[model samples]
Target: MQTGEHPQLQQQLMVQNSSGSLSFNSNLSKEDEEMSRSALSNFRAKEEEIERKKMEVREKVQAQLGRVEEETKRLATIREELEGLADPMRKEVALVRKKIDAVNKELKPLGHTCQKKEKEYKDALEAFNDKNKEKVQLITKLMELVSESERLRLKKLEELSKNIDSLQ
Candidate 1:
C-alpha cells in the first residue's frame, strides 16, 4: 500500500479473491433488482421533499420582505404628513405673533389718547370753577351798592320833614 494511492483501489484489491469474505453473485434475481429500484425511488422522493420545503421557505421570506416594504412606505408617508402639519403650525404661530404685535401697536396709541383727553378734561373743569368764583364775587359787590343807595334816600326825606315843622 503506497501512501498516496486511492482508498477505493486499495479496498478493491483487498476485497477481490479473498476466501475469508462472502462474495455476491453477478446475476441478480428480479426481486433483488426491485428492492434496489425501491431504495433509489425512496431517495429521489426524499430529495424532492427537501426541494419543496426549500421553495416554501423562500416564498415565506419573499412575503415578509413585501410586508416590510409596505410598512416602510406607510411610515414614510406618515412622516411626510407630520412634516406638513408642522410647517402649518409654525406658520400659524408666526401669524399669531404678528397679530399680537399689531394689537399692541393699536393699544399704545389708544392709551396715549386717553391720557391726553383726561388732562384736557381736568383743565376745562378748573376753568369752569374759576369762572363761577368770579361770578359770585360780582354778585356780592352789586348787593352792597344797592344797600348804600337806599340809606342815602332815607336821610334826605328826614331832613325835609324837619324843615317843614320849624317853619310852621
Candidate 2:
C-alpha cells in the first residue's frame, strides 16, 4: 500500500482480488456463495435492528431535551415573577429606612431640649427651697419681737399702779 492510500480502500482491493482469484480457480463452490449470501442477509438484518434502536434512542433523547428546556423556561418565568413581586417590597423598605432616618434626625434636637429643660427645672427647685428657708427664719424673728414687747408693757403697768396708791 502507498503511504497516502486510505486503509479502507486497501482492504476492499484485497478482498476483491482474493475473491476473483478464488472464482477463477473454481475453489469457491455454489454452496459457499449460498452460505455467504445467508451470512450477509443476517448481517443486514442486524444492522437494520441497530438502526431502529438508534432512532428510538435519539427520539427519546430529543423528547427529554425538549422537556428540560420547558422546565428551564418555567423556572425562569417563576424567578421573574418573584422578582417582580419583590420590587414593591424593596421600594417600601427603602422608604421606611428613609423615614426612620428622618425621625432619628428630628429626635436628636428633642433630646437636647429635654436635657436643657431638666436642668432648668432643677435650678428652679433649688431656688424655691432657698426661699422657704429664708421664710422660716423671718417667722422665728417675728415671734421673738412679739414676746419682748409684751414683757415691757407689763412692767410699765405695774409702776403706774404704785404711783396712784402713793398719791391717794
Stretches off by above 4 angstroms in model 1 are 1-97, 160-168
Candidate 1 TM-score to native = 0.37
Candidate 1 local lDDT, residue 109:
99
Q: What 10-residue stretch in candidate 1 is worst by lDDT?
A: 1-10
Maximum-TM-score candidate: 2
Compose the digit string of candidate 2's lDDT tens values, residues 1-168: 333433443344346545764222254356544554554566568879999999999999999999999999999999999999999899889999999999999999999999999999999999999999999898888888777777787788778888888899
Residue-level lDDT tens digits of model 1 in 1-168:
333433443343346424455343455456544544554466568879999999999999999999999999999999999998899689889999999999999999999999999999999999999998998898888788777777777787788888888899
- Clashing pairs in model 1, backbone N/Cα/C closer than 3 A: none
Error of 2 at 21 (Å): 36
